[model samples]
Target: MPTVLVIDDEDMVRLVLRQFLERQSMTVVEAEDGEEGLRLLRANAVDLVICDLIMPRADGIGTIMNIRRLMPAMKIIAISGGGRSHAMELLKVAEQMGADHVLGKPFTRDQLLAVVARCLPGHPMTVRSSARSG
Candidate 1:
C-alpha cells in the first residue's frame, strides 16, 4: 500500500481523513501542523500528502513550497476549510506552489478519494472512487 501523510490542526478533521484513507487501504500518517508533516515526509517515504491551509507551525503554503523544492515528485493535495472565499484563494496559491490538487473543506469522502486518484496514478488504492455517487 502507498503511504499518505495528512497535515491538519483539527483533531476531528485528521481523524476523518485518516479513517477514510485507511478504508481505501492506504497507509496513513498524520501531523498536527505543517512543520511536523514536513519532518515526517523527510524521514519517511510518503506517496501523497493531504494538507490544510491555515495550520500553525508552517502553514500549508510553506509546506507545499518546501516539499516542491525538496521533492517535486511527491504528490500533494491541499485542503482548506477557511470558508469558500479563503479556500478558493488558498487553492489558487496551492496550485501556484505546486500542489497536485486543492480541495475545499466539507468535502465528501468520495471527493477526497477522487483527487487522490488523479494525483497518484500508479497506486491502485487511489483509483478506487469518484466525487459523484456511483
Candidate 2:
C-alpha cells in the first residue's frame, strides 16, 4: 500500500478522508496545515500528498512549490472547495507548481480515489474500483 499524506485545516474533512482512505487499506498521515504538512513530508516518506489550497499557514501553492524544490519526486494533489473560482485559480497554480492532480471540494470519495490512482498507478487499491466510493 502506498502512503498518502492528507493536509487540510478542517478536522471533519481530515476525519472523513482518513476514514475513506483507510477503508482502502492505504496508510495515511495527516497535517492540519501546510506548514505541518511540509514538516511531515520532510521527515517521512509518502507516496502522494492531498492538500487544501486555502490555509492559514503555508498555503497549497507555496507548499507545492517548496515541496517540488525540495523533493522533486514527490507527487501532489491540490484541492479546494470553499470557493470555486479560487479553487480553479489554485488548481492552475498547482499545475504550474507541478502538482499531479487538482480536485475541487465536495468531491466524491471516488473522485479522490481516481486522483490517487493517477498519482500511484501501481497501487493495488487504486485499480480495484471504478464506481463512486461515497
Candidate 3:
C-alpha cells in the first residue's frame, strides 16, 4: 500500500483525509504542522505528501523545498484556502517549486483522488469514491 503523509493544522482536515485515504488502502500518517510533518517524513517512508501552504513553523514552501532537496523524486500535492487569488498564487509557486499537483480547500473527494491517481499511476491501490466535501 502507498503511504501518504498529510500535514495540516486542523484536526478535522487530518481526520477526513485519513478516513478517505485509508478507505483507498493507503497508509495515512498525520502531522499537525510543517515541522512535525518534516519529522514524520524523516521517520517514515512516505510516497506522497499533501501539505497545506499556510502552516506555522516551517511553512509549505520551506517544507516543499526541503523535501525536494532531500527526496527529489517524491510526489507532493500542495493545498491552500488562504484566499481566491492568494491561494492560486501560492499553489502556482508550489508547482514551480516541485509539487507534482495542487488543490484548493473545499475540494471534492473525486478531485483529490484524480490528482492522487495521476501522481501514482502504477500504484495498485486507487481511490474509488465520489464523495464531495464543501
Angstrom error at residue 114, model 1 = 0.6
lDDT of 3 at 61: 81
- Model 3, span 37-117: residue lDDT tens: 989999999999999888876788888888889899999999888455678788888888888888888787777887877
Q: Model 1 RMSD to the real structure? A: 2.9
All candidates in order of lDDT, best leading: 1, 3, 2
lDDT of 1 at 64: 92
- For model 2, what is the C-alpha lDDT against the true structure? 0.82
Point to the candidate with the largest lDDT.
1
Model 3, CA-based lDDT: 0.84
Writing each residue's lDDT as its tens digit, candidate 1 over 63-104 gives 999999999888898898756456777778888888888888
Q: How close is candidate 1 to the true structure, as a TM-score?
A: 0.90
Candidate 2 per-residue C-alpha lDDT over 18-128 given as tens digits, one digit per residue, 9 for 90 to 100: 987898888899999989998998788798898888888678888888888988998888888675565677677778777878887887888888877777888756444
Model 1 lDDT, residue 14, Cα:
92
Give the clash count for model 1. Answer: 0
